[model samples]
Target: MNRPADKPLYAVQDIPGKGKGLVATAKIIKGTRILSEQAAIALPFGLPDKERRKIISQQLKTLNNDARNAFLSLQNRFPTKSQYVGIFNTNSLCIKTSTDEGSFVDQAAIFLIASLINHNCENNAQQSWNNNTRRHNIHALRDIQEGEEITLSYVFSLLDRAGRQALLKKSFNFTCSCRLCSLPIRESQRRDGNVQRVAALDEVAKHQRSTAPLQSLQCYHCVLAYHLSKYGREDCEYAQAHGDVATLLVMYGDLARGRYFAQKAASVFRTLLGSDSNEAAEFAAMARDPSRHPQYGFSMKWKTSVDEIPYGLGSADLENWRWERLIPEGIAPFADIPSKEHFVKGGTSKKRHWCFMGEIVKTKLLHPVQLEVKDSGDKKLALHFYSSNTSDTGNSLRPGQYQKGYTVVILDALQYRFEFGCGINQEDLRMMKIFPLRLAKILALNKEVREFSIRHDDGKRKCHGCGAKAAVASMKRCSLCLSFWYCSKECQTAAWTTKAHKTDCKSLRDPDLRGLFFYNWDEAQDSISFPLQVADDSC
Candidate 1:
């Protein structure tokens, strides 16, 4: 086989521990189109072995002498009765085409040079079918040095190291020795965990059509973070994740951020799949006017014009504004409480302080202690306590504490899917607390915290007592809740007595309640305790 006159970037060569592979002959810049070639043979997909072999033989007769030689030279690890069929199976790449009935059909085609590229879990190049040109195009995902092997990932999705090894060995009859597969066990496991979490978040995004806009946007942000942390900017999944987030933001009427993310997604797609790809063209247009999208305006909760984006922000502030990730000042970092509806089984654990605040309607101690309770949302759910000692279930509370109107707080609670109903399973003694206040009073206090107590770095901090912005550290925080700031002791006392803080201060004094504000909820790097100072400097 001979290389075409225009194809001078790479050449076919014998690779170590592998058969014939493509090796770069000259430096290839990122986003460069390295190879574009028509298939030497094509056959219908899903055909029986006998029928496919007959078709392959017929196509083989029509190939020119050079093309026929190249097809015959391709690798065939699984040899069978029909040599032509085995060669086709080993070298053919699946391509989408239309059938005579005007419906889509997947067809397998053998490309002489494209098939010669080897497999790598962390591939430096990507391949796609260019339907407009009726050929396969390979683009450099990153700059490829001369003498380096041209590679692409054979698997559709990334998997753990062990899973990748098993899948490659079973399907391709070879083990992958890529960069990711050769990492230390601990580092490899961390990367695998990130990928798995992102995959879970992807499933959540798919089912979030009926979910609230803010909640869906949160899920998409979490997915994007996982992808960037694991695969960095070069991975194709990173771009796709941004696209998912952009779509959700646009749907919820966040036009400024939506267009920003859409443009980022379009840039990456242009690099990986070429500017002519449908994904690149579609996202490029969406970035120009996000409101034009079909799914745009599902909710107007975050409505903003495309030109309303902030300017002149520092790099860190720019990212915070772009993602809406600015931690509200004064409101405890991990303690931005979430509802039970946000939970998903086998999904990523909650990284912020969330409690199931419910009134105990009834109680039973049969085998495992159970309580029938109604949450802040007025939805009833069961709370099951599964401690080794039954005494630990109530946390030393008297029978009077289990009254129908008494509020029970379970910290960092998750949604437990039970045969009877979906509820919460209280496991840790320290994670649960009982408050004398009713559920309504507690929620009202929480609303106050969200509005007046939370701080923002826009050079403003509203005094909880006087409702005035203080300069720097001139204000003092209420020592109990550490929630509200005051300009003076007199103001604090007047507000505490007159502003309903008198009722909320006692409930906030509980160690568990204070811990919720201080604890690091994103991920546990180390054990934590009460009177939580910023251990990770995350705040």
Candidate 2:
């Protein structure tokens, strides 16, 4: 059916410092397609300069008079021997082409209108190549006001201000003074550090994706959080992280959350890449039917259908469910320390971290310190500390924290085969924690916290002070840990004094301890470590 023509979305106009660039003529809502056009010239990456010039010349000649004028009008950042070749080189955008065998290769193409959209470090518009339509589409990532410059990011500008300035000058032949690049010195340095940290996290996710998909998934979630904190979540990278997390969740048989993230991905893709783009369609389908994904059922441990999505949840509770929240205490003794075989075969376990508790039966202080510790099962094992942190040892533990029967909690615990017997090769001081209490007592408290601290459907809450089950509201919650409850001042005083709640409360206040319990163990957000900055009671 034929329809009335819509008004043009944008117009090419003079941008003070940017010369001629696209500017929004009318209000463009987020996710609305600003432009969708085919390339005038295309060339595969890694072609010889001579061959590239020849290709550009051929494609340029085939264009109509008006198209040729628009193509030639594009900025030539690098003025080559041939102006046509220079124009193609400067204006070309990356377009990925895949083989029949499902392998992808990079190709660069020049689009008439898209080539005129100027660069911005924090662009309101996103550019994408439509795999199905074989066209370049520009979509408003965020709502663009009429008369606002319609810009797209020219580079992955996760670089420091100096680096960004240098790169833009060298490659794009212009100095960028975008908001990010124009920040104050101190703020710029802080932003640069976050940039480096995000880059490092991305590398970690890539490396751990195969060996530790759970860890990789957590890292991707961390990336999403970083995106939320620094750049807004509407960024291209942030949208991609949503898809990455979705894929991992699906592989782990978490269809409920996988579909949720897929839905988020689909929404962002629709807004950033247009609904007709391959990315949007692919995620839309996955959100509708996650079981259709190639990696579906890779592991059924977290098996749940899309219908399992919780209803009537508040935003905070929804986030906790969305990011698989971990109960540090509950995970403590679920599995034995991983042996060398497990690590070598690639950690097939969904968890990237675990806690190993063992009581100190013997101690040997030397270059490579050794400690004989006993676990809950009364099984004794030798722990050899080959850690680079020489200052932190059993003696270095808090005055009363280390004792004969005191147990050490090692996060990301691993087992090794020593000449004497199978034991732990202690490394990374941050991962090791020496509780003043015995392993049995520590575990008992862990059990208590799991049962009593949390609210039940029946409104019953266990008083940390008296161990008495009471109405949830009748109990006074512990100021710290945010996990323990108390009955009355009388019970609270008695528990704090007589019931050993004093020492337990102190331990509960430890960020590292709280970090363990609240950290997402399933498909969650935020990858935590020691010196943890944990959020106050997420649930």
TM-scores for all candidates? 0.65, 0.64
Tens digits of per-residue lDDT for model 1, 369-463: 67888875677778787776666544444565566677777655656657676677776656666667677876676666655665666755678
Q: Among these predicted structures, which one has the highest lDDT?
A: 2
Looking at model 1, which ten-residue stretch has the lowest summed lDDT?
Answer: 326-335
Candidate 2 achieves a global lDDT of 0.73
Kindly report which residue pairs in candidate 1 clash with one another.
329-455, 334-353, 351-521
- After superposition, the stretches of candidate 1 with alpha carbons farther than 4 Å from their true spots are 1-7, 98-103, 230-233, 325-440, 445-539
Model 2, residue pairs in steric clash: 31-271, 323-524, 324-523, 328-517
Give candidate 2's root-mean-square deviation (CA, Å). Answer: 13.7
* C-alpha lDDT score of every prediction, in listed order: 0.71, 0.73
